[model samples]
Target: MTVNGWQVSGYTHLRELGSGASGRVVLATHDATGTPTAIKYLVGDVGADASFRNAFRGEAELLATIDDPNVARLYEYVESAQGAAIVMELVNGVSLRQMLRANGPTDPESALYVLKGSLLGLHAAHSRGVVHRDYKPENVLVTAEGTSKLADFGIAMPVGREAGSSVTGTPRYMAPEQWTGQAATPASDIYAATAVFYECLTGRPPFEGQGIIVLRDQHASAPIPTDPAPPPVHDLLRSGMAKRPEERPQPAAAFLDILEATAVAAYGPEWEERGRRRLAERAALLALLFPFNDPAGGGTAVAETVLTESSGFGGPGAGTAGLGAPRGRRLGGAQKALVGGGLVALLVAGGFGLSYASLEGDPVESSKDTDAPVVTDTPSAPVDPTTADPTPPLPPTPTSVPTATPPAPTASVGDTPTTPGRTPTPSRTPTRSPSPSPSTSPPPPPDVSPPKIGRSAASPTVIEPGTCPYGARSSTISATAEDDRTPVEKLRVRFTYTLNGATNTVSMFPSRSGVFHGVLGNLPYPKVITRIPVRVEALDAAGNVGAGTVIYVTLNNYCTPG
Candidate 1:
């Protein structure tokens, strides 16, 4: 089947992992290497645009450069006339957002473990001068082994550069300076990371506001919540999320020392190990909700083991088949009680008074209600997709809107209404003034339009294979791009051709002429006739994208008969 207008080639589509406005992530196996991977692709108009493709390529390039264990790895990036795709390491685990939603409020040890891993990852990026502008739970992935790694560097920027004028990032976790449009620094990443650490400990973010404007204000001046965590961990949260960037740790690496010290002092030397175990357990639980096929075909078996061993719900014969069974026959009394108790613990742990929006789908929106907390009920055992019963509906989650209080207007000094120096007559009856109502303007809708990519062309479209028998073949490819509003941020060209029995690909960057130029050398000597494929893309500052035409260069070579 075709995905986002491109034919599925060189890989087998396994199952969909998740989807968002930008695109969908899917589980797939590479045909050549037989390795499973998570492939993210742009969709519809965004995929068709060149600007988004450029951004996608940029992300790929950044990922390819980083080699930290706590960061997701990049495998391949494919760009063609039809679309663009990124092949990345498929993390065999769930996002930290999903973990918190499944089991509210991690213990202090576990919270520290998560933070330490995240910090290490952020430090790796910082050391490379890359700042993850969008650091949050959703971007942190916890593998089955309980190792937490940072994912989704789509909006990452260099350390010294400002991301942009428009505010970008989740409202609740943004740093104070980020709200003020300052350049993203390692300190900002630490701030956002600490916000997530607070969520892990308290089951909710540190601050709550009715809307984006208020949320920004809260981050700027709201008191850091440390009561959720023990006294020992308070300093870490405070210093990491200090309102002033100067007050916080300078680089992300510096905070690691403090965190480890605090963790060791409070939870002992083995606190990290304990925390990772807890995370692994949580990840195991999440697998039941979002099941994906493993390239090795044993993912389901391992999941069943984790479920039965951890919850003590099902026995050997009581396989996941019962998950699709009728609701009444699915769970026994003891199993039901265990599941119910777990849910209650989650609720109690999450009773921090602040509301939390579900982090399952796209970035949390300011307008969405955050009243009813998300709960992961006891689901039936996961059945094979082919033979599985129709999945049961999850319980309805409640939404709550915070009541907004308008600010009291203050009278300016010496501006009180008075007739010269005459005393005002006392009123027969005093009237009580009503409190001014708060304005309830909704945040503006996000920009979703893909950037426009201009048509591209290649010079000397035809090349004789024998002409480069002992040398290289060179060609210049050029393309332009524009966005409806934002300026074109980047443009890239991917040149792919088959040499011998393997495929070779190269990425080309743009020059001063607003055109991407590259030289393709070491072309295979054509035995008879051959064709090479090439594609170009453009990206806008906002990450909206578009692509250009796919062209092929024909090479003709023939040996003259003696």
Candidate 2:
């Protein structure tokens, strides 16, 4: 009822599609042209809420920009006298969620097919530099012909754009950095895609039984479900659902590749078409093996046709039409054996393949556990704790005092010396200082001076605003080193990107110091959030080159929750 009534004069609401906290969506038709579309109307006081309005406008703009075949296309966006409305392509089919409800978890082959199609759309969006902050089955639609498309970019943004005034993403699907109020990366998108895969294979998300914060905690600290998948889909889902973005496939295209490979391996080559054939063949065999008691039924009809065709009795030799006396029982017996054997073999092979594919590998090694410990070298000279940055300061005072000795008598043979060089030499014991254990201290051990090129606090990387946006064309980016080692004058970094079948590159430069720094300017627009693989390399005047930390990017809100 909330969806049927609308203020727009050009469109007539037909039925409810769905609703969320911000608005209600409905199926509608344009009055003049009679074209169908989905109309989303802002509900409540969202129009009065600046944060909400900004988010709504951002989403509308993103939807308007998408131009990919795999992504749901936005037709138009307009504000009617009643409220803001967005007209989107009306996908005439059920959400993947509904399908799952009606049919339980799908077979691995079917699931992968669905996932692959979705990734293609996502890649299109990523290529254009957009990230779909939210990606889930509810936003995925299957057409009457069974093609799948990704829907909704309500919270999507250009790669480096600052997030809106309000956090605009579904908590369940949000990445860890999102929850922690940190910027997201392409790896975040990889995490979300994998989450979808987990739900598809297990009929639920990877982490269950928790609120958003709890879920975030689970994402940040808990291990991905170590349990195996239902079948061949296991590898496909596991690889996509890796907790760390880097651990997952690099891009939607890569994800699709893995999904397709697994699906083909699981169901046998040409599994989709082959499955239909196998089903038909089995049905046909069943009819022959168990002919109906009544001559008018399916079993008898099938048997008679087979017998007539096999014996070349279609001509004059054909038996009388009405229940001719039963032909030799041998035909029934042989058919049963053949059909039974074939069915068993098919089942056995299918089970084996699925079991092999579904085997989840050992838990992945976590970065927290695997990263090289931070190395902090102590300054050669002791720094004053009060004036310094409140770190790496004075050593503790010695607690045990040396015992005092009595003055010695001078000019006596048995008297100890009391004057210079006569008193007991001060004990040469070196006092121990209270400080961080050797192993616990960061590089440049506590007592050692700072290294020639001091490492800065792992300053988190920054992605400038609008670099990645939802649903547009793709482009290339370059990153250069600007550290003590490579000065801006000598720095040169280049990289490439392909969108809608076009490719280009960006040039980057480093600063005076060697610490690598560069901005990957103006990425391509993406139809969905997608990941891009990037590698950075730095070189010295001597032609000696060093590799940089590998980082990945996605054009969407793919962040890990804090």
Candidate 3:
């Protein structure tokens, strides 16, 4: 809640730390010490709910009383009409969950370091009769030095026999008792911590499924996955994930002891020394391994060094090394002679066979006779027998035919004509061989028209941030273009902003309205009103250029470029 222009009464505001469905966290300076603190202010209905308000008070009291270095210290609690706010020590770190999402699962050594730190924090909270019901990666923060701090103790409950019946912790990290609507004890927190460990090893929580209901079943009944964790860590996760609270580690201190023991067992003197030695060895091994690791390193100096210096040869000699003897040496005198002789014999045989085939075939005579006149100009004539025999295959030697013939004998009107001494020709008509029919179908048409150029509509105009009065911090610039000849199927919009001598451009496309919107993120604009200059152009469907217009518009005081 806001009070006296400060979010929450106990501190003065500096900046917003974070906002969530639960509440907003703002960076503030403590009134007495002037030190930076994160004030979590829960406004509206959360202040009205007795249970939610009690949760904030309970967490504040627990954090204020604790002396753990890993826990966020609560300085004070404030109640006002705007909201209930808790002022706590500000943590300078990114969340472990964020790191995991960005970098994937951590290596075993890194995971162990984080787990050990979380265990230390949990142990301290447990000693003071407070249970961190939500012990997931999201609640763990890691500083620049890799130091981990367990955070988000706003829902932590005091140790007691009786408990409320509402479900609180994230279901994916919740224990079986939590899913079954049972009280969340220290054992429940232990189960949640083990869930985080499983996530670290597998890159996912142990009970991920289709939905919340399916996940609850998996967490409540499905077997904990067999992790590739070391033997000691495996046992710790197994003990912490037991189905029943009584069956699992009963206290957070017990869980912490197991984690500490596992860390000590895993981080042996040899392993620690090996890790350090590996860093030192990376420099030398960079020569032998780097080039091989990257195949594209061929043109690089590293590849040249590996091939030349490492192989005891220079440049081209390195390429030929160990590739066997020269080509001339590999082919001996006798084998070379045999290969040449065989090639010559093959060529001679092929030539002879081709010549014989050409002489034996009658292709020339067949083509010449294909359209020979059957009856000359008179439309009737005797067929030549020798020519009709398909130009009998040529003999070994060429021969010529005699062209001289006896004159035809004169005959009476009723007598048949015949050659001089030959008998009258028999009355008979020669049979004709079939001729191939010519096709009557027409050939396909050719395309000869010139291609037309395609023109696209100009992109939509960009809407500048600070042009609109509301929501100036998160604003968008838009641009649009339309074509008269053809419908605009695709639109492209570009946005450019100049800040501090550097110009940044962003491009976007909108599916509807042929418009494009460019969103500016976290950009602070001038707080005084000024004109924003923009360029706009349009192209028709036929690619004909339309009007190009430069526009200047007055923007909200906040949108002017700094």
Global lDDT of each candidate = 0.57, 0.44, 0.46
lDDT of 3 at 351: 13
Model number with the top lDDT: 1
**lDDT of each residue in 122-177, candidate 1, tens digit only:** 88888877777778777787766678878766543222223345465667788998
Cα shift from native, residue 250, model 1 (Å)? 3.0
Give the per-residue lDDT of model 2 (tens digit) for 1-562.
Answer: 3443333334566655444444556655444344444555555554234454444554555555565656766544444334455555543234554344322344455556566767888887777666767676666655433556676654332221233423335555656666565545555666676676676665556776345556668777776673746655666556665665677787778877776677676677776553333222211111111111122211101112133344321122222222123221011112221122221121211111100000011011111110000100111222222234534578998787555884542342344445685446444445576887569555642322211222221111222124221111121222334434434445344334443456544333322222333233234445665555445554444445444444555444332222
- lDDT per residue, candidate 3, 1-562, as tens digits? 3433435432467645344444455555434233334555554444445676655555555656665657655555555443455554433344554444323355556666666677778878877777777677657755433466676564532222223445556777888877666756778877887788777765567776766567778887898776555565788778889987888875666666766666667776344333323222211111111111112211211101122233221112112222122210010111111122221121211111100000011111111111000000011122322124435686687565656884554454466764487678444554576887987988754433222222222211222232322122232334555554334443223445554456666543332333443334333355555444444333333445433344443334442121
lDDT, candidate 2, equals 0.44
Please report, as a residue range, the 10-residue window in candidate 1 with the lowest summed lDDT.
348-357
What lDDT, from 0 to 1, does candidate 3 have? 0.46
Please give the TM-score that candidate 2 achieves against the real structure.
0.44
Ranking by lDDT: 1, 3, 2
Better of 1 and 3 by TM-score: 1
